[model samples]
Target: MINNKKYLVSFMLLVASVFTSNGQDDMDKFVSNLLQKMTLEEKLGQINLSSGNTGAVLGGGGEGQLIAIKKGEIGATGGSSFESIKKIQDAAMESRLKIPVLIGLDVIHGYKTIFPIPLALSCSWDTDLIERSAQIAAKEASASGVCWTYSPMVDIARDPRWGRVSEGSGEDPWWGSQVAKAMVRGYQGGDLSKNNTIMACVKHFALYGASEAGRDYNTVDMSHLSMFNGYMEPYKAAFDEGAGSAMSSFNLVDGIPATGNKWLMTDVLRDRWGFDGFVVTDYTSINEMAYHGLGDLKTVSALALKAGIDMDMQGLGFIGTLKESLDDGLVSMEQIDQACRRVLEAKFKLGLFEDPYRYLDENRLKNEVLTDENLEAARELAARSMVLLKNENNILPLNKKGKIAVVGPLAEATGDLLGAWVMYRNRDIVPSIVEGIKSVGGDDVEVLSAIGANLTNEPNLRKSLSSPFAMFMGEKMVVDERSLEVLIDEAIAVSADADVIVAVLGESTAMSGEASSRADISIPESQRNLLKVLLKTGKPVVLVLLNGRPLTIEWESENVPAILEAWAPGTAGGNAIADVLFGGYNPSGKLTMTFPRSVGQIPIYYNHQNTGRPFDENNKFTSKYLDISNEPVYPFGYGLSYTSFEYSDVEINKSKLNGNDKLIAKVTLTNTGDRAGEEVVQLYISDPVASISRPVKELKNYKKIMLQPGEKKEIVFEITPDDLKFYNSELIYDWEPGEFSIQIGTNSQDVKTASFVWEK
Candidate 1:
């Protein structure tokens, strides 16, 4: 068996080399020769993009695609399939030079076995956990025959309204950069040429985060210093860790769309940051330039080519019209050659050149695809990402010796638990919250549960706009599989007599991601009405909200005793949730994004710049909103625990330094409550003044510490120059000579502050 395995490896290597060898010793040699043999049209063909017969949000995958690929007219394909992958391989074989087609997918969270959204992962503040999550995602994705994933959306999102913020690492670049590296390492692993490792594409290449008004594909403007100092770190970090590709964002960075901004794509991403990967335009980003008034497709394609976009993702113009532009002298052959070479290099790194059919092997494919192990991993991640929002009077760690009423839309939802971007997880495999509760509760706890309502109250949201919800879920637009009013009344009655009401509420899978953006982020009115009935029962209630984005739950927070913000935990989510509820794991998650008081306070953030009209909660006007307070309902880095902790004795090893010194900042934290719990000791920096207006405070460091009852320890963070600088108004990043505040605390809003002066 060992000898056979060795022989298989040898055979694979030999097969890989012939295609990977660039037909010569050096990759550049192979690329130059290949480019030389290519026609102007074929070179132009290298820049075209096409959709697969299936998997597009707008359309589904086909043989026509195979025909296009075989003619060497197609370069890249998005929304491909296992069958499509095989067909593309056959087509590539028919091409004169036999170059493999690079298949890409929006394997955002997971291709098959999904994990929590990136925002949820950030809440963990655990890099190892985040990496492991990505590793699991990669394993399942590669198993499904996907070569590349447009993931690890590293754009630092401060405004939750951006909708795509659900796809990012939140507002802290320090933490964001850490997650960026973790995700890149997890996706690519130590090997990119290996089967389990899919190429990780770091996305929205430039400043897609600072979008105007938190709108998708919105205009973005920021100083170079601000970009370099904060927003660009994650992209740069991914590049440093060897990301396989980059997706240029649709937003205009400064004044130019990142897809056509030569300075951003070439000067910064490649020349300055030294990233060697190819750049692809975001979905239809190239074609949208006409909307931006960038002339015709011919002019824009030339601009994009010059800007460094190699492959066009779903941009029909690049693939359909680049040839005309080439002949029109709009874009040069050498530029086409460079773009094609980059794409070819990416294919080489993926080890597709060696044996393109390696991933297509049916025997191995059957063995590795969505194994029980991967599902188990997803279940574990789901559990860990669940953050206990509130636990008043120790309402959680539910007693196994009581009548437990598990009530709401998500309690018995097997499909909803997997959440969004979970295109491949088998729903039946996931045990619902009730199943999880019953599994662990055993004969000890009497469990009664009811689906109080659908995820929303609006007939338009659940059913159809014009139709009544009577025939919904069976005929018209489905309103979940349960009866809403019947379920709610039953749940209220059940909870009226129960010892505890574990009211599971919040969004179903269709609620908060991508185009699922909400103007009003709150628990559904149907569920909220159900909550009112349950709360009236006067039994201690535990609210388990299954949502994607941070929601407004001030009423629940102030009224309900316990709230668990389980942001659509994946398969086994119910089980993990049960475990946390029964004290299996003390919830340690902190919010990466703030929960505002209302949608009116949409842009609220902890790291926000102090405006000229700053409001002190004491005042009514200025920066404060009259109807609602300026403060976030729940601040970023805020999460409650069953046990309590105390922070004290902050000490700095050195107050001042002339050089790049490792200044140690320490704080003593004690588990003051009886039960042992974990704490995220957040460290933030405040630049009193800068060449540009800067955020009042920025996250610089953090440590998640676990302590037994009465245990105390000091966590020390080494301060560095990198943490002190920001991109100035002039686009230069350097720390100004001024007093800086180093604050350490349990949450972003409440912190212990100290002053230190930086002198040159």
Candidate 2:
């Protein structure tokens, strides 16, 4: 048995070595051969990424652009449709070198058949499902003629005030890295040459999520140790999983714009991490460097190229000013060639060089996109993405036998269901909350809905919310202009005739993505008024929140008997919510981000460092808030299932460990409630003493499992010294020989623990 195990290990090692050696050799050979034959003009064109109108909120390119493509003046485009991409590729075929154009898009969550937003999807704690969503997105997108997707934004976001928090996996670097790897594998598949797969691009290169005050495109300043410890894990994870491309962020990394930051782009990414993928700038980011006080377009463009940016997305800086910069001795020919080679290498790896029309199948487009099978998957995923925040007295798993009154501006909202970065027409096809309730509840349950209030009561505020970028934000919710009292009265009237009320309330889709940060992360005043009136009617109220970021819902949590965070669940959102509400599906999703009681706890997260003086209600000198406690409304990994789970004390296989040693931590979990359900078993490690102060507890591993009522299951996790390593004060990545705590829990705060020692 020992000999057989050794043989199996040897075989796997040999296979991995061969895969790496051959893949790199083939890619380098193809790119080199292509580069040798290319002219200066063609080389520059390969580093140019312009945009085309796919009816989304980016640039538009037409026949004039097609002529440029034929001249080998364009390399890639975003937001272009299949028909348009075919035209662009056809134009490229007429070029001297016939290099195919790569079609890309911000296929964030889902392509046509939209799923839950990224933030909500992470709540499932199901990497397999997240990967499946990415795989389906790739299939749908590739069918539509796109070969690349700008997604899996794995930024570790702690501040909910950042609107783009909706686009990421939440605040824990360890968990976020896992999600990142899953997304990359899902998009690129095992082989990039597959006709159904698309290339994955890890985005916003550095700490764009930690923008000051949670504002988009703001300055980011953090220590090197902090960067390595916290923000850099997801990008590294994606690269390790073989993502083909990266996008430079809009923010400055230590005072220099990321587009022109050499230490970041070259030293950290290329040299240290050994990333061979091409780097592209976010929309006009290279050009925006001028506004960042870097220099003129030409100077900043030259800096970006020198800093290792391979392509300029929506910024014609490379094509327009690179040659001039070259002649001026501001950039070298070798640097230009290197950038161009990387871009061409991506095309080669995508199999576009061999067959330009590989992804342009009309039959696949017809059969694959928005199919019933895909929508069903979307519905199932959306159902899993929902986190049940509060279920007082078992108020949820609601019976479908009663009349359900759905009230709020978002209750009947169709467009908002398909969150940001989606086609405008998707809203027309999605089922509204009321429609979903009706569909799932069937003939027995009567579902009635009313737009209880406008998204906001103030007229001027509604106007301010309007966005010129219509495709990205969608048209602002139209105000009723009727008196607030009248809207509340109608809501009350609807609830009076129903056995139960579902108050669908929260931000509109536009209010929680990109540049849409909110200072007050709560139910809007108008919706709060509507909810209060509904509560007064003596009906059992269920607060169904359809939002992007984590909201401060203290009032709702206290007053409402049940609260469900639906989180802009996509095309089949209504149906998914219906399934959960009507007891067809049990809620298993956990909170990836912390839910604060108030916005004052802006940057609160579970893996926070301990203060010199820890919080103490008894001591006035400690880090305690006089007005409120330091606890969050709902801690990270917190969620409620229809059935409850009980955890046993953590048992460790070893009390001491040395080099290459494995420690097994085990715990017994039992479903103590009446029904069968799923739970996320989380394992966290704590370094009580280290060179630098570490977080109170860092999540190391997690598992999602199902159990029948009264059934017990044993959960085991293998731990190693490598898991104890962190970036220290000197920025050294290594573990210290010390005592550590192994915590096993359903959530971060509630845990059972055991201790062990490690010697170097």
Candidate 3:
């Protein structure tokens, strides 16, 4: 058996060597040869990323695109289907050099069999699950001829008001970095030459989540220390995981647009971080730079090329004006060659040079897309992504034999279950909440449903909230024409005979994605009124929220018997929710972002620097809110389980340590309840004194473990001086030797602490 295993490994190595002979040296020589034969027009075309005529939001180019492909005037195209992409590849085969075009797509969460949004997935704290989901998405996408995906958005979002928060991993930079690395590994795998893998594009290159006023595409400004410590870790982590591509954000960095910022793209990303991948602009960002107070198309295109941008997506600036800029001495050929070479290098790595049609297999598309196995995996992930915010008196893991009443605007919602950035999903196949309850409840269980209210009271607001891409995707927000009074009356009548009411209420799919930021992050008036009336009926209510971001649910937190944060669980969402509700599965998810008590606390987060005068109840001059407490409604790393768990005091192996010593911390965790449950044991570090101010505590490590009732286990973590290091005021990364606090807990707010000292 050992000899056979060794032979298998040798065979695999031989296959890889055969495919990539001399590796990087071979890739360099091949691209260099191609660059010599290409004219100036062809070189510019190598950096031109056109859009397909697939009715996508950023789609363009119909017959003209085919002509350009034949003339070797296009390097890549996004948003194209299998048939269209095959047609585009055929056109490329007719070009002078017969260079095939790279196919790209959004494929954010999933391609066909969708999973929960990235924010919700992060709550699971299961890197293995997240990685498997990405692998499935890559399989489905590669089968459909997509070799590149602009995904794994690693922006660390602190403000829940930022609509794009749904697309990121959440507020903590350390945890978000873990998610970023997992996603990159999942998408790219160990071998890019395989047809099943797709190149991962870690995006919005710089700090895009810190937009002013939590508005999308707004200007971002902050100190260098804050930038390095708070927002930049995840992006760097993704790149370090061997991500092959990146997308420039649609915001300004250092007073210049990211598409043309030399310091950002060239100095920081390329020189400092040593990112060797190609960089692409986000949806005509170069053209939009003109609106950002930069020069016209010609000037911005030249600037972007010199700033290390390799590809222009949906922007004709490069192919249309680079030659003019070259002739006018505005840009040099060397810079253009560098960009073109990187693009070609990516193609060679994808094995496109060996076989352009490697990923366009019809059989794989027929058997792999939306398979039963993939859907089952999606269902399990969606269940794990659900965070049980509150479960007073153990109201969840509901019995399947009771009469279940499902009510709300989203009770029977089909399309909304898939959430945002799902371009290739089959909404008709998605089972609604009512359907799921009925199917999972069985013959003895009785199920009832009603539309309690409209998504919003105003027709104009509903229409305005619809996604712009809905027109092309055959999607529209369905608003009932009946009056709110009539809807509530019907809802009340339906729930009167039920044993329990499950209110599936929250924002529609259009309410929380790009450009959908809201000033009031609370339940809508229409839905809130319905919920109040239902509560008056004296029936037990379980609030199942479907929002993308953390909402201000202070009222519901106080009134609702139980609450579940089910953030737009994807295609199998309903089935997954039912699985958790009926005790088929145990929910073990935790909140990745902090839930503020009110919208006024826009920037509330767990790891925040202390103010000169910290908040105090007795000190009138201290930093405090007069109307409310300074604490959040639900703190970060917070969540509930069906069974309870207790933590013992933290134990340290030593109270003092030297420069190279390792401090060992241990905690005894016991399941104190009557059922089995999973718990996320989090570890945090705090420095009492530093060269500059530091956050109160920063998450350093974590472990998710499952414990049966009455089980007791010791959790241990080894800390080195490296874990205590941070970027200082002078931008130097190091640690200050001093007294430090080590904390271990179920969540950030509730923890047992121990102190240790380290000397340099």
Better of 2 and 3 by TM-score: 3
> Where in model 2 is the C-alpha error above 4 Å?
1-26, 51-61
Model 2, 155: alpha-carbon shift in Å? 1.0
Q: How do the predictions measure up, each by TM-score?
A: 0.92, 0.95, 0.96
Model 3 scores worst on lDDT over the 10 consecutive residues at: 1-10
Residue-level lDDT of model 3, residues 1-760, one tens digit each, is 0022433343344334334563888788778877887999999888999753223333233667788878888899874577787777777777877787888988889999999989999999999999999999999999878899999999999899998899999999999999999999989999997989999999998899989899988889888899999999999999999999999999898889989999989899999999999999998999999999899999999999999899999888999899999999999999999999999989989987666777887889899989999999999999999999998888898887878889999989887888788877688889998888888888878988899998887656577666465433324667788887799999999999988899999988888878778888899989999999888989888999998999999999999989998898999999999988887878899999999999888799999999999987888999989998899999999999999899999999999999899999999999999889999999999997999999999999998989999999999999999999999998888999999999999899999999999999
RMSD of 1: 4.1
lDDT of 2: 0.87
RMSD of each: 4.1, 6.8, 4.8
Better of 1 and 3 by TM-score: 3
* Candidate No. with top TM-score: 3
Q: Residue 551 CA error for candidate 3 (Å)? A: 0.5
lDDT of each: 0.76, 0.87, 0.88
Ranking by TM-score: 3, 2, 1
Candidate 1 lands at a TM-score of 0.92
